[model samples]
Target: MTRRLVATGLVVGLLIVLLIRTGIEQANLNRFDRDMGVILTAMKDEIIRAEGGGVALDSFVTQLPGWQQQLETIPPPTNSGYRANLLQSVLQFTVEYGKMADTQPDQARTAEMVENLTQAIAGWDEQLRNGPGEAGHSH
Candidate 1:
């Protein structure tokens, strides 16, 4: 029957579309994971390097806006989970560091800022390894 054939074709088409969408989403997630790993590790390294007294808060103040924009582009699921929280902390630290850089440009407060961001970055890295364990993971 033509009706039966049409129904099956519709179902097959829908399934293919679903598969394509899922594949695209998976690719996006993979890229996001890789980018975040690099970003977090770099941030932590900069923080750790602050001990040697060469980590310039002014450079961070300029650099963080781009990082913040990248963080904003991360999709949901993990975005709403611990990853989002950690990103918020990073953004907050960026703003605070910028403000602090305006006044004293000292190492003590910069080190403290780095410590806070280091903790957030560590938590984010752990969350990434664990995968998106939250409720809104799309198939």
Candidate 2:
């Protein structure tokens, strides 16, 4: 009877530990989702304002390293394909905006960049829906 009690206690303890770990992981994923949403909204707003020269694409680029650093600080599963997609979108926006600001200097290019960014975001969303891990993860 004592042996059975010990085994049951051990099983219960292990189950509790697993539950706690899962909860923490879920919380981290939630935080990642919230942060990504905020960043995407800001990007969309900037693209919209680019038509009036109100958006500073260079400024956005300059801030990206800091954002990337923040992402790196998050624990694993937080830096998944969604984060990669955000980085790609930001890079694409910067390059396209720079080109438009230089040669075209018009709303057409700004619109194109916005569409590209949107498509990139959508692609990333699809990837996440199809897989739970990072797209580049080898394991």
Candidate 3:
């Protein structure tokens, strides 16, 4: 019957649209994950270098601006509160680093900051994997 055919066509059209939307979302998610991984890894590396003392600490001063920019520019999913929270942690670290980098904080103080940053990164990563819940803040 004509009515049956029309109904089937509408359902099929909607199913195709749904599939396309899901694919697009998955692609976006993949890109976000890749970008975040690169930026976060760079950040953690710099923090580790700073903790090592000497030239590595000095390098962080130069590298941090780029790291911050990368994080700022990365396109997080528009609807994700968890991504925003993770980014907030990164922002806090950058702000803290800016404050302390100026004074050239002592090694012990730098170490303390590094530890806090590492812990915050871990917490955020966990939140990202397990869904948003009470993320621990370092700053």
Candidate 4:
């Protein structure tokens, strides 16, 4: 009887440990989702500011460094290869924008940039909802 009791207790203990670990993982993922939403919104706002004019563009430029910092704070989960790429794209965008903003890329080019950014954001959102799969890139 004592042996049976000990086995039961061990099983229960293991189940509890598993449950706690799963809960922790889920909480981290939820936190990641919420944080990513905030970052994406900020990215959109930057593009909108660029769409506005010089003052808004200046504001956008000022905000981007903060955005980059915020992004770096949240390292992508090891399970998320696609997410890592999306984050890289965002960082690259900020760097590219800094270069382009200096020379002031033409309005048409600016619009194209915004469009591509929008597509990338949408693609990542889809990936998060569904599952990670191939999203082709170019040279």
Top lDDT prediction, candidate number: 3
**lDDT value, candidate 4, whole model:** 0.68
Question: Mind giving the per-residue lDDT tens digits that candidate 1 earns over 60-108?
Answer: 5556677777767665435235545555655676566566666666643
Query: Candidate 1, 17: how far from true, in Å?
Result: 0.5
Instruction: Sort every candidate by lDDT, greatest first.
Output: 3, 4, 1, 2
Q: lDDT of each structure?
A: 0.64, 0.56, 0.70, 0.68
Error of 2 at 78 (Å): 6.6
lDDT of 2 by residue, 64-122 (tens): 55555554544445435555555455555556555554666454345555566556655
* Consecutive 10-residue window with the lowest summed lDDT within model 4: 130-139
Q: Which ten residues in a row have the lowest lDDT in candidate 2?
A: 130-139
Model 1 pairs whose backbones collide? none
Candidate 1 stretches with Cα past 4 Å from truth are 53-66, 69-89, 107-113, 132-139
What would the TM-scores of all predictions be? 0.66, 0.57, 0.78, 0.71
> Clash totals for all models, in order?
0, 0, 0, 0
Better of 1 and 2 by lDDT: 1
Cα lDDT over the full model 1: 0.64
